[model samples]
Target: MPTRPRSSSSARISSAIVVAATLVAVPPAALAQSGEVNVYTYREAKLVAPLFEAFTKDTGIKVNTISASSGLEQRIATEGANSPADVLLTVDIGRLKEAIDLGVAQPIKSDVLDKVVPAQYRDPNGLWYAASARARVVYASKARVAQNEITYEELADPKWKGRVCIRSGQNIYNNALFAAAVAHYGEAKAEEWLKGLKANLAQKPSGGDREVARDIAAGKCDIGVGNTYYWALMSEREPDKKAWAEATKVILPTFQGHGTHMNVSGVILAKNAPNKANGLKLIEWLVGEQAQKIYADMNFEYPIRSGVKPHAVIAAYGELAADPLPIATIADNKKKAATLVDKVGFDN
Candidate 1:
């Protein structure tokens, strides 16, 4: 973790500070004088800075951010009731469920959130709300694969033998996909599908999703599984990576009887939020049209709010027909998914 000086405008606290259990106190006068909110997030600081800055400009509420890649949930658990965290923002339903299960998040009753976000993407008790979504889809080599359509079950076909690429099966993104399989198919069949998918691996599962595209561009594989946003990012922002993006086409693969699998980047209210009112305000604003556009466009994600279109680069991939499998159902089967991954030796 990197260290930076704290200031009134923004502060980047290390995970070390969080684990050390040292509560950084805001001076009583500062707290009373300026309406502010403290956020601990797993989201990249650069990705969220613009949103926070916009919020401050509009509402005069100062935003303090603590960014880390992992261990945020545990750190909050360690801090107990004295935690200064007002909100927790993280990607993936698995992590959000972890926070909820760890008792770090409290239920929120926001009419704005309820109206803006679809029920399928949010917690039933309102412990968390998804702000944006990304589909888990197939990335097929443009030169080798001519078919525009594919299904998740088709990846197991022997015809694709030694031609599939994927990240580690234990990764939350893949885990959720597998969990969805469990939701649709029984565990026995989902496990069998895992073994078949593993047997089709071009190489031992490794690297991030972009690497899958890179491999496809390099002729290492004909098809790979990855999130939709990575292709959008590679095409628009990463000039050096554009070739990788150009080498493949996005294929929204569906379960045999269902729509495409989707995951989200979500937000939660802290159980002991000191500035509850302002935190709620921030949450409400995040789901609004303007803020939703900024938040989604920054990362090439689809805004969860109705009536907001995805960024043009993402829209080019066509609209996502997200599988209606409840996220909670997937989260519940996460452990079963992980166990099946190891059972199949997917990373080996």
Candidate 2:
């Protein structure tokens, strides 16, 4: 992971922050206090700064965030009974499940969480709760593609040969989608579909989802797959990337007989949370309308709270009929999904 510049209000925990193989900045004493909550997150620091600032302003409790692109669960495990982390925040059901499977997360019994988050978007045992969601949708070049509708299975059609672009098939985002295919279509048909989709690749699978839109703008491909949030980020934040955003229209794709595939950015209560009370307070506040609004407006995600609307930018893509597949179902099949990706040589 590249080093992110530090924010004035929040410290960025980097390699230098570790001392004698232990994270030294956030000690258990500090975490146990009433004024602060410590968070170990896989989310980008910059993206979550505003929410933290707002949380502090709304309540007197301060938010101390440790950001890493990966390895958060392992770090907490290595810290053992002395870990100061109060909460774990991450994207994708795969990472959430990993935390539970690793025994680093404890089941949270919160009536607020149970009421605010939908059943399908949370763990049945309450180990994790999704704060927001993103759908995996198709990005089509506005000038070249005439149809507004498309299905995940259609990306494999022969007419789309050499015209589709995507990141690594082994990525968690893609893996979850592949897993969904398995849940809906069984292994044999899913593997056959994977082969067909790989045969249509415009280039070797590489780059992040935003690159799919960039390639579409450059006419490298006519259509590709990406998450809804990337398009919103490009359009709202990166001025130089506006052309790419303008080049394509987002089409919410569904499994042939099912609805759109969706994923989440979720929260978990650490097993060894030192500030358990403050941690619970923060988790409850996160699902409330005010925080959900921040998630929608600042992050371009669909809020998990019932009755909260998505930001206008996301709403423009049209309402999503998210596939009713439970996140746990998709997570359970992740290893099998990876196997199919390899069996079909998706990135080769």
Best model per TM-score = 2
Q: Candidate 1, which segments miss by more than 4 Å at Cα?
A: 1-34
Tens digits of per-residue lDDT for model 1, 294-321: 9668888889888888888888777677
If scored against the real structure, what TM-score would every candidate get?
Answer: 0.91, 0.93
In the range 1-348, model 2's lDDT, one tens digit per residue, is: 113444443233433322111121465453377798898877776777777788889999888877766667877887888888999888888889889999999999999999888899999888999988999999999999999898999999999999999999998899999999999999999999999999999999999888999999999999999989999999989899988999999999989888999999999999999999888888899899998999999899999998889999999998799999999888889989999999888998
Worst 10 residues of 2 by lDDT: 15-24
Clashes of 2: 0
- The whole-model lDDT of each prediction reads 0.84, 0.87
* Segments of candidate 2 deviating more than 4 angstroms: 1-25, 28-31
Candidate 1 pairs with clashing backbones: none
Residue pairs with backbone atoms closer than 3 Å in model 2 (clashes): none
To one decimal, what is the Cα RMSD in angstroms of model 2 from the true structure? Answer: 4.2
